[model samples]
Target: MNSNYHISSFCKIKNNEVSLNGSVIYNNENNNFSAFIKAAYKSLETNYAKFFKMDALSKLAFLAADVLLKNEHLNPEEENNIAIVFSNKASSIDTDRKHQQSIQNKEDYYPSPAVFVYTLPNICIGEISIKYKLFSENSFFIFDAFNAQHLLDNTNSLLSTDKTKKVLCGWVELDGDDYEAFLYLVTNKGSIIHNKQNIVKLYNT
Candidate 1:
């Protein structure tokens, strides 16, 4: 794998906590992922109305991506060349649970297309791609846990491709009131080497 890629910046939201670049930015007393996400959104001043309509999986991914994508180091000239690769343990399981609940019984059956839209794991990437205007390669993977080796390998492979310039890679998982997202921007420039060890260290931090 080419070592040209570097980690520009990263953000982590685990449980009721929020951190950026290994520093704690927000810590909530209550263990509510929704509240924590919205608090971070308001604090960051992300004025996107569509955020409300997104499922928890998309919201988690969008919030983390919003943080990394805002950096000036990201060149708009090659935005389309920026690919997104994400992994998660749940794979939109929280939204799936809700959708299942909505149709569990005929007496209360009211299936929602809105909720159904996010049943697929890749929907979060779709939401992010639409919001950020990324038209290049994008994919989502499901893992038992954050497999640093897989992420590192795929990122390196994508960057090795002549078509891809930079990549937004990370993990997004949510289940009911529990959620965690560790996202990073990998570019040809930055201080930290975009490798497995450092990626795992950043996620752990």
Candidate 2:
């Protein structure tokens, strides 16, 4: 297999702003996560109704993936060749708290199926897969911090094999008001070499 894989493109979303390839493409400092993401969705001008219903974590990942893959071309025939490897410090705790609170109050014990559905961190990955129709392998890892080396290893393992031609990997962490998402598309085509150093550098940028 090919030894040299590159990060074709990367997108960062945080602090009410969205950046592509380390450049700020969208910004709205006045709103919180919910409003900011809704504005970002409107900016895309693509109608995906389910976006509004998704929990905070899902929305964050979905928007980042949308920005990363919006202009990139993918073969529909080879949909199964694309893989998603995502990691986060907090695994859907934002929604987990909501689910927990919903049932904790005995008098107002109203368990919400919608909120319960997104309690799994991997659900964000599933949302992205459904949008792109990618049927390949997908994994969500929970790390104490941004483990770039681990991410690099996971990505390399997939690309090193013939099973996957491209992998969308990154750190997407969201906890309450504090949130950050960095997603990159990795493949054999691109200028930036996909290595541990570069991954950490790009993620910081």
The best candidate in terms of TM-score? 2
At residue 98, candidate 2 shows an lDDT of: 94
Count steric clashes of candidate 2.
0
lDDT of 1 by residue, 152-171 (tens): 98888888876588888999
Q: How accurate is candidate 2 locally (lDDT)?
A: 0.87
The lDDT per prediction is 0.83, 0.87
State every prediction's TM-score relative to the real structure.
0.92, 0.93
Task: Give a tens-digit lDDT track for model 2, residues 114-171.
Answer: 8899999999998888878887889999999999888888888887776688899999
Question: Model 1: which residue pairs collide?
Answer: none
| Candidate 2: Cα lDDT at 13 | 91
Global CA lDDT of candidate 1, please? 0.83
Q: Can you give the lDDT of residue 177 in candidate 1?
A: 83
Off by over 4 Å in 2: 1-3, 75-80, 106-110
